[model samples]
Target chain A: MENTALEKSVLNKRKTKSLILRFMVWLCGILTVGILAYILLFILVRGIPNINMEFLFGEYNSDSLSAFSSIVTTVEMIVISLIIAVPVGVFCAIYLHEYAKRGNKAVKVIRLAVDTLAGIPSIVYGLFGMIFFVNILGLRASVLSGVLTISIMILPVIISSSEEAIKSVPDMYREGSLGLGATRLRTVFSIVLPTAMPGILSGVILAIGRIVGETAALIFTSGTNVLENPTLDLMASQRTLAIHMYMLASEGLPYSKDMAFATGAILIIIVFIVNFAATKLAGRIGGLSNGK
Target chain B: MESIKKSKFNDTVMQSVFFMSAFVSVLAVIAISLFLFLRGIPAIAEIGFMDFVFSEKWGPVNTPASYGILSMIVGSIYVTAGAIVIGVPVGLMCAVFLAEFCPEGIYKIVKPAVNLLAGIPSIIYGFFGMQIVVPFVRDNVGGNGYSILSASIILGIMILPTIISISESSIRAVPESYKEGSFGLGATKEETIFKVVVPAAKSGVLTAIILGIGRAVGETMAVVMVAGNAVMPLDKIALLKPIRTLTTNIVTEMSYASGLHESSLIATGVVLFVFIVILNASLSLIKFRSSRN
Candidate 1:
């Protein structure tokens, strides 16, 4: 009787410990989700009321209406940078995936270079932009300089992600196309590229998100003057939304706090929209693959 | 024969384009390195390297334009160290629970949350820190609104996603056979995890930590907001006082700076670049060794 009771108690203790362990795991998962939700909710609540059409379209003034110039500048930079980066990045990804063999030293060097570039700090890119584009090339605080700098900053991300996307296309497709007597270029451009388009689009969107949100690189390369709707001239320095928000928060002028918060809200919305679009595109691609 | 010749020509052209693409990326890296080195060397040569690195006075605009990056470097180290201290354990534990202990439904939710965290911009993080952390620390820690402690906390939060994701992947990559073997030896699940799995994933975990360090070191906007921007290095008495980091110092001073001062700030960039190069090389080496082993 004594042995039976002792064994029963030990079994009961083990059961309780296991239950506690299970509960702890559930609690951790809940806590992580809770914290993230809380942060998103807090920002949305604080920032939403401040966002308005005036805020999106108005000129930048410390005293009067909201600064929309920053938004325009940001969009311009994004367009210009994408114009440069996407073609180059896609071409590079194609080169790596389609043409290069496995054992080439040049391929190895390129891989290492891209990895290292991705690891380098944004501020260093900004510094380089300052010296090379602004000084030597004489872009002089223009949107062109910002575009050049940001292109280099996000090039690795675009290339690597697009390369992965392209590589994920099965070898069977390539073989079938070639067996049909199609040229390699024709095979890649039609069969592989279209199939990889969703992934490439997703990569581009993510890169755009990074470009829109970036501050450090822009600060040095793009001059922080808040102009109202900049023109095609690349030499004029312009302020982006992030730079505007930083300036407002740090400079401590009148009504700057309100403007900064409002700008932050706009930035959040823009980023959220871009991120949402990218996620949706990725999901659609995933679904298509699953359907196959 | 004609068709064969055409195909060969096409292959050559495509191959050349591939080679050129690869070469351009390498050229970019070389150009960046060269520009930074050429612009930065003059300032370092003028300042005498040791004093430039170790001295505390950072004012580059006063009578003599005294500039030493010592305090900023210390501040960077202090904050990054604090962030690592807070981030690693929590992150590792979270990773453990996620990989080893969680059920499928729970994993689904938790995984997306981590991804979202990783996706959020750093500027928003800075805003969050300013609005939440700074006020909380000022009210609770008996300091003014900005301090190294606040910066550290924010950084800790910022780096958590990286740590959790990387560590979780590593822990998951731990072979299942090890777990079965441990179980067969009459080990409990907890013992199997703590003993067998974590050890197997040690190098990966170490890599995660190194990556976290790199993030913390390179982070600028968030640190700029919370670190109070003290130009000079603080004494022990002023540990809670705000101080500049190397990145922050460069950002803060670059606007009004001219001549050697501007060049010295760029030199700061050189220092930052060197640190990143060292970090990348070490990480690659570690990864290489780990794979080989």
Candidate 2:
């Protein structure tokens, strides 16, 4: 009887609760992937067929320019914001990761500051952009305002990611460069930066994705009117694709609904391509670093 | 000798360059705080604190227009709470699966899918919610499709990436020794995970939830699209009812608003700023405590 009881307990060791738990986990995992697939396929199915050159580049009235200009504005925002943000962010990372002494109070404060900056909601950034850039600084609801605002919004992200990249440059590389009579500055610029370029580029890609997709912060700062004739005037208000999508949808104009979907589809495609590349690059970095 | 001198000079110049660059972040934060206060406070003062925050009459276009944001505040809270309810369980489950249950081949696909979710822009999510969830709500649940329910569903989906990624990392950070010990003690795998492993990662999971709330609360474009954005009484609750959040309030009205109305919107931003700051402080405190432990 005792032997039979032991066998029965052993047979029942894979409990029903465990089975249920396993099922739930799988259900959730599949559910998450399902939701993602649904969103992508749904949007693409509706958005892709609508996308045409006319939809993309043509103006509402033939007299004015079209969704094409929003694309232009997005590019301008990306370029201008990155130009301002990248160097400063990289240098700040350098100071934190390399120059600052370990366990220092100042470094700790700065580290906390970056985290705080990261947590602050993007809408708050919008208000700051409006008050400081658009009003006080007289940027006047232009591309310049959007650039300045987005630069700040992306700063903490760039700093944190770039710091991680810089940190991954093994101490031996830095020591070897310095031991070869290279100045500290020379070691960072010539050796460390080059080796860390892939990682930094991946961070920049992420930042670009963010800049392209952002709408709310840019709404007040950039202002949502697409320029009639695209020019190099950073002072002129222009729409981004995301803002265009928002405006078109919110207005509930029957004619513009398909255009909004097409724009969303285009936006999704761009973001997807960039994201896929970043993951591949990150994977490569992992392999390279592991090999080293 | 000349080269050595030049190298020393380069170090000084680059060092200062780094200093100034780092200072830019600090200066920017200070400027944001300064400007928000400088612009936002006077508007609140002019409106009166009780009147600004307590009254629900937000019709700035009406005769003797009012600027109270109580309804918007309630709308934000309701939407955020609903998101937390909808998002946290699914996200936490997905995190646990990824951290422990996922097979290698499945892991690769699952991981990228989560990243893709994160990468998809907010506006697209807004569009998706507007197209799908909004209509579903309107049809099935009654009332206009653009309700708190619609915003909640979208925000819920949007916060999944944040919650899953952070919670997964925290679960992974749990020491292998603890799990092994649980196994040796004859705990079932589910028992070990639920009773031991998940508890060990409790603070981290809490951090994830908090961060998710922050994301949901701050979200503007998506919420504006789905939430009906009506200024209504807070005492009566309806899932299918239209309501305005603080974000949509500012975004919707700012374009047409002028004079005191504009300032009131900036003041609305000030209230949001305070909410976010409090959330950040709590999140960091949690992190600090967890690190100490």
* Residue B247 lDDT, candidate 2, scale 0-100: 89
TM-score of each: 0.93, 0.96
Model number with the top lDDT: 2
Candidate 1 regions exceeding 4 Å error are: A1-28, A230-232, A284-291, B1-11, B237-239
DockQ (C-alpha) of model 1? 0.48
Give the Å error, residue A129, model 2: 1.1
Candidate 1, B1-293: lDDT as tens digits: 89877976886787676567656678889989999999999898898798688788777878887778888888788888988997787677778889988878888878877877776777777877888888988898868878888888888887888888998999999888999999999766766776799889998898888888888888898889988887754574255778688889888889898999999999888888888899899899999999899
Stretches of candidate 2 exceeding 4 Å from the true structure: A1-14, A59-65
First chain of candidate 1, TM-score? 0.90
- In terms of DockQ, the best-performing candidate is 2
* lDDT accuracy of residue A100 in candidate 1: 77
Instruction: Give the distance in Å from residue B292's predicted Cα in candidate 1 to where it truly belongs.
Output: 0.6
> What number of clashing residue pairs does each candidate have, in the order they appear?
0, 0
